[model samples]
Target: MFTTVRQQGWVDGSAAITGITPYASALECLMHYFREQQTICKKCCHVNYNHEAIQQCKLQKVDFIWVNRDLENFSWFLQLLNDFENEQLTYLETLRANNVTSKRYIDFHFYFTSLKSNNQGMIGYAPFDLAANIYQNVSNRDVLTKMRTKTILGRPQWSLLFAKFKAEHRRTSVFFTGKPVMGEDIKRWCDQYQFMYYHEPYF
Candidate 1:
């Protein structure tokens, strides 16, 4: 079972299924459980999700898994908390359309449900809150210093930016960023949160 009592702001369904910020941080947490090597977790960092970084992690026997807790994957959710194993996202996508509805379409309802839930399970909103606070203080800093430049699970998880905003506003506020090349996921997140902001979509 996951924890209840979610923080204010951010979509109700949006939760931090993974305890750490980046995938590396999650892996580091795992390492600390056994090896207790603080430096190993700190030094085992990645830049832009490269092959070398993944290879290094695998050499250490660390499993790279991105656990996003949405309402859509009942089977996978059971696997994550109970089975203690990672589910391949690739397979989830292939099965998403088939089991969701008769017509093919993207399923974001799980994320919506997660955000709306009172008990946020194991997910927390602290990381995004910290980002928003820091962004306001240092919005003019270098791109890499900002929230959006960081990636989660070897991919750009755009939700981090909104998580920051939600921290300050005390409500789930998504930003459009208004970039044409912006991903569908970003657009959907913003739509669900009723957010309206225009920028490069990158920090």
Candidate 2:
């Protein structure tokens, strides 16, 4: 069985980012992740003062669980995700958008470390997947650098690869509902997550 918990919570209103308004669907979730930067997991947290929160919405009651890209963290992360789901402690937009009709939107995935491995997480290859579509829209190394970042070993090389993949995936549909993300550093982060730009982009 499942239950609802009511307690104190925290939201970094000042730490807010711009993105799409919350829609209630997996497609919306995917689209929001690709378009907006509103309240992300990193800048938010849920607080409960009672055990009821943990006992509600067990993993068996939720949909799928996405593991991290790392195998070692996969199981642990799934359990953690389950705990959050059981407590109904997902993001506000995600909860409202997904729960209204399909309660299974909480499906978990992994952050893909390498394609060679079998392990996965909540969302894998998000950046690469997105880049593969609109890479050609990007023009020069300077613009790429201006758009993304210089973190990976081969910034120039990765940018080129990203561009190529995006060009191939250009036909993919994306909704630009939120604000436009600026800065090479921010763009780089979006690239890592597979978005050429984002509103209220995260680091």
**Least accurate 10 contiguous residues by lDDT in model 1:** 1-10
Global lDDT scores for all candidate models: 0.31, 0.30
Residue 169 lDDT in candidate 2:
42
lDDT, candidate 2, 1-203, per-residue tens:
12211110111111222221121133333334323333334455432222233224232222221111233423432343334444343443444554433233233222222332112332454565446335535642111222221112111233543454355443211112211322344356445646444233322
lDDT score of model 1?
Answer: 0.31
Candidate 2 TM-score over all chains jointly = 0.20
In model 1, the runs with Cα more than 4 Å from the true position are 1-153, 170-181, 197-203
Question: Residues 38-88, candidate 1, lDDT per residue (tens digit)?
Answer: 122256541121223323342222212222334343344323322222122
Query: Stretches of candidate 2 above 4 Å error?
Result: 1-69, 89-109, 116-186, 189-203
Model 1 TM-score, all chains together: 0.20
